[model samples]
Target: MTAAKLPAIGCEHPMAGIARRTHARVPPYAFYEGRKQDWRFSMADEVTLVGQEAEGLAARACRGAGATEPTTRSLVAATMSAALFGPPTLGFPHLVDYLDSFRDGRISTNPQPKLNRPFAAFFVSDADRGIAQLGFDQAFDQFVETVRHFGVAIFTQTNSYTAGELGYFVRRLAAEGIVGLAATNANAMVVAKPGGPAVYSTNPLAFGFPMGDGSPPMIIDQASSATAFVNIVAAASEGRSIPAGWAVDADGNDTEDPNLALKGALLAFGGRKGANVALMVEMMSAGLSGGPWSLDTPDFRSGDVSPGVGMTVIAMMPGVDQAARIARARTQADRLAGLGVFIPGVTGTSKKEQLTIPAGVHRRIAEFAANAPAAGNMSLA
Candidate 1:
């Protein structure tokens, strides 16, 4: 595939005294043609393509990496995780470069700069993509263990794709009675406001605080932007318009057009307040973690590019009287429930909620897995 040139950068100046400045830049037009524009296909047909094309290439890379077993497992695990948390189209292909980087020794498994506090830092420098959660899960488990021993812990991961929902990583800590906050930075996709140059990456933030009872943890997850980039791509692939205020055109004008949004930038959700939070996330994920700033990150929507993103996980133990604290929180939740305010992630959801993959998608995944071994992939016991 030929590389698309970056559009020349220029911004339309706002009328005098308007206070809002827009970035004048055009998005790379052909960047998404392969996936978003030419996406019309039967589910089965798409699945076949994923199996025959995507998986076939992935299998070859795994063998070349010489870590076939772990790489194959990571690919399957990422695929399963994506299926569980939707936008399934977004996660798996990213693994191609990640596995290759691992084989090439571009990614380091060692933690950097030993810390006095319970902290660990990992840098996957080579635009590594998939298996963020693999590292995240291990880091979270270690963080939880460390927090249990030291009262708090922090885990920083830099240079990976978006890594799905931040809440998914911390909720595991909450299950063990630990409070957790997770954040990540992405490629520049969200602007501080309409008519503003894109400056942030939606910069998701999530918190999981245990409520003590057997009920689910109190989980809060959201992108600071009005919408996530993946969701924009999903809408574009489906030929659906996005909601107004979710994104802006190249001129920084608000637009509901998904195609324009893909080319433009997303708006912060709550205006300045959301942008402030996004800034905080950027600091924690990229600034402190030694990852590239969102503007420097490569676009993941286009084929196997490292997102150059970063993630931070903070885990802490509740106070000494954790039970009492939880009871107090439960009282507040009960009061809110009396007022018809459901405490999401706790009172309103079932832990047993089933994840159902469409037949075609599932079949395609199965076919890919089956073909992988014969195509140079390895199996785990």
Candidate 2:
């Protein structure tokens, strides 16, 4: 039960050294009576500050690419500030390449194998445009199809692009009667607190479940940060200020100034617990998937290199009485609704329409749209 008795493995990251020998803390005696139980013990705090990469910037990479598309006018408006100011020079080429990947589902790694195992690994190399565009969706659909044949599938993807809207993938799968859960790590942009070093990305996580109705599935997606970095950038672009505790200044002091916060770091949603979740995500996305740790990935804002990140997707098949299970879940949801407990994402899923953007943000987006090169034809130089 001590650290010295645990197994250890040599790794490039400092935390990995600690991780190798830490699994023995939960002694073998912890198993249940007459049966062996599964247990996963992780080192969640060691590497938190080592090189937490910029997940906010990674989110911006997808937001920027989506904004450039003709079909994403509203998205463009919402993210105009980031496109115009955040990494206008270095982030553009990466965005363009990600968009190009959408035209063809050709990624470095393909998921064409059997889904019989409970876990599978999928790697989308930086080559062939990575996980941008609809490539991930295409790959995920294939995963769902294969998993449905089996009972459950847990797939991890490394070396992928910045995955935007992690819930979108799960929602569609839920509609197909497959429950889906997903999480992706980003570059470092958040801290444990104002005085603490920024050690983790506001890693986004999502889950979707089928309701057995023709309506949209029940989906919930959220970032671990106090607020998504994109919103702060948008607010800064409009010369607005953020609320206290959302971000810190360069000296690690609390600040409402968006610009100052950008120079500093974002605050985790709930102190150590949020940081713990971020680390959990980092392990699943990068640690387990053979992807670059957040600290090792290139900075998405000014670095010309691709954001080498990872995503984890899990698909679960229901039992033979699937309809009955779904009906029971709906009944619970109905009871909660009757008690005035609102379900997240229920209303937004049923409605699809454009959201209004600030005049300044909209104007900036218009200018960028008019002057930008074709997504596939962009150049880093």
Best by TM-score: 1
Question: At residue 233, what lDDT does model 1 achieve?
Answer: 60
Q: Assess each prediction's global lDDT (C-alpha) against the native.
A: 0.56, 0.50
Instruction: Give the TM-score of each candidate.
Output: 0.67, 0.60
Tens-digit lDDT string for candidate 1 (298-381): 654443455646777777778777778767777787788789986756665653233432233333234333333344224343
RMSD per prediction, one decimal? 10.5, 17.9
Considering only N, C-alpha and C atoms within 3 Å, which residue pairs clash in candidate 1? 10-24, 11-24, 22-195
Per-residue CA lDDT of candidate 2, range 242-349, in tens?
Answer: 989778878888899988876777777676688787788778777766667766665443334556576777778756677887777777776876888876545434
In candidate 2, the residue pairs with backbone N, CA or C atoms under 3 Å apart (3 or more residues apart, or in different chains) clash, namely 52-188, 53-187, 53-188, 54-187, 54-188, 55-186, 55-187
TM-score of 1: 0.67
Badly placed stretches (over 4 Å) of model 2 are 1-128, 132-135, 230-244, 256-259, 301-303, 353-381
Count residue pairs with overlapping backbones in model 1. 3
Worst 10 residues of 1 by lDDT: 15-24
lDDT of 1 at 319: 77
Q: CA lDDT of 333 in candidate 1? A: 77
